[model samples]
Target: MSKKRKRVSRRRLAGQRVLAHVGVHNIETGEYKPVTAARRYIAESGIVPPALVNVRRNEHTTDRFFWGEKGLFSAQYAEENHFLFPSLREIVDRIGEENLFAGLEALASDDWEEMEEYEYAFV
Candidate 1:
């Protein structure tokens, strides 16, 4: 008997408009810096295990990049490797593992008007 291959659905974000450049936030100091400045600071200070927060936006929605130990990851990646990320672990603890994906989907489908409340700085 032949094994059937599972089909994977790919979501596209090609039409999204970039609202801002990549920004780095220091988890300990709560400081936000542009990518270039963050790189310099990380190099000079030798910040242990530097991670980057990348944002992708469009006229309608936004997507955030989660920086893992291995590399940049999406929400799905964080779901799969929740153990590797502190934030995701905390979320799982609060919301339960099963509901994590549903919550993320809801957040992603939320109205764009709510996103306008905060000003996004273009680095």
Candidate 2:
């Protein structure tokens, strides 16, 4: 079962400049590789990870219960679409809030088993 995200009264991360590395997650393997190197891997392999949300600063956000990073899911958008999400909240809009978080949490932790749990899981 997936954990429920908390409804915080206010987003504590507002206006905070956090140190973060850009990276991509293999939706199939739940593996995370930092960018440039990750870009090369994707190009040479011709495989696109379902999501690219691998930022280290937001690792703190994941510390709450699961590896939950609100703004991080955009890494995938950046990789696939060649641009970062203008609004991270849109991740919720596109993938659905629960799915964006849960899907990403699975990727962030390198949980290949959890990733493969899906019926359409990639080989």
lDDT of 1 by residue, 70-89 (tens): 54555444433344545434
Task: Tell me the tens digit of each residue's lDDT in model 2 across 28-55.
Answer: 2225444444444455665433334332
Query: TM-score of the candidate numbered 1?
Result: 0.28
What C-alpha lDDT, on a 0 to 100 scale, does residue 107 get in candidate 2?
A: 23
Look at candidate 2 and give me any clashing residue pairs. Answer: 52-76, 62-68
CA lDDT for candidate 2: 0.31
Q: Assess each prediction's global lDDT (C-alpha) against the native.
A: 0.37, 0.31
Q: Which ten residues in a row have the lowest lDDT in candidate 2?
A: 10-19
